[model samples]
Target: MLVSTLLERLQSDPGRPRLTWYGDDGERIELSGAVLANWVAKTTNLLVEEYDVQPGSMVGVNLPVHWRTVTWALASWRVGATVVLLDGAPEDPAAGNLDVVVTDSPDSWTGSSADLVVVSLPMLARRYDGDLPPGAVDAAAAVMTYADQIIYAPEPDPGRPALTGSGVAGAAGNAVVGHDELVPEAGPEEGVRTLVDGRGRAADVLRQLLRVWAAAGSVVLTGPATAAALEADTARRDRLVATEKIERIA
Candidate 1:
């Protein structure tokens, strides 16, 4: 029920900015609560109707710390799927098996025999422009065809495994909140604009963003921002609270 709870919170403030993403190419994206929830709903439908992702299924997310990744995580949790964070498409024989793998890499699953989903990571959430690898589904193209509202037959269990790390342990939906709350003061005030560094592991960044959302705060994520760039952007810095550390800017 973690996904539902978060969605309810977001719907309560539909117009507020929940996620602000800055791509490495300087493209900016802002998703309000309502917009984000709609995307989550569409994604859930895609997983259920297209990929047949159900409860107890393992979904490997081999993407970066992008807004689409957040959408995928929330959608997977909504259907009671356990998300596995992969740096890229599983290539090694020792990478272990997965029910499904989602990645933005162009060459992912090029010659492999795996169920892979490819995302374009477009600025407008558009489909990929070029040719896609064989046996890989285009996520952006497929997801848009799903309904905005999710209509699942069975409800998801909160006690089921929600997320699994690369080498670390897995956590159930009921325990995800506790895990995010482990960092003291990591949660920001309501409507506060918090800056988060996206250079760390995708899982870590996603966890931090979840904490911010739990506190009803908006996030300003940057990719490898320099201290000089941070200082130069006074407008962005002034909106941020002093509690934000310098390391976060870097």
Candidate 2:
């Protein structure tokens, strides 16, 4: 349902900057709806063509809250694959049925049984600089090679699970969310321009972005760049709101 809305918006507002990021390393990247859509399409192709992620197949994602991770989640859903949130280290056995695991720190998953796709967090990354495992795919490089639009039709079951987040050790767990639970449309267009603090839980951040986009809104995701500086300084935070023309902070 969310994916359908996104496809519609991509055609209508291709130039609108739907996702903007402020990196901790003094960098800013903005992805218009069309651009974001292209990345998602490419990722979907990578999942289907390279890994054959069909409906009900699990795809583990263990990465920080960033624009790239957002793309991964959307793409995983596009192909009817269940997006499973893996807690960073791969040693945990909460969800072992994952067909592929997309992550930044590939070292942790040294001998992971599932296929690994190592990702570089930077927006401009063409390929991962670090060495990958024997069968691991360099997602930064591979994603670019895939087609920019969806090549196959995917009719996923609405009753099947879309996302699953299992707790690792001491952390709280989350319940399975089916496609039916993903509401087709937001109540009304609130025109909310959200300022996202990147320190929140990964699943929560992804859900917030999905809701904001579903409402036909935009997002300004803040990395450690503004989160740390604005944490203690109200004045700085106010200036950011003014500078970014933010309507809400998520």
lDDT of 1 by residue, 98-144 (tens): 67778887586665555778887876657877788776788878888
Displacement of residue 23 (Cα, Å) in model 1 is 1.5
What TM-score, over all chains together, does every model reach?
A: 0.80, 0.91
Best by lDDT: 2
Candidate 2 lDDT over residue span 151-220, tens digit each: 8737566777788775311113336777655434674756688898887777777777877887888899
Instruction: Look at candidate 2 and give me any clashing residue pairs.
Output: none
Clashing pairs in 1: none
Off by over 4 Å in 1: 92-95, 111-113, 167-188, 225-250
lDDT values of the candidates?
Answer: 0.70, 0.80
Which 10 residues in a row give candidate 1 its minimum summed lDDT? 175-184
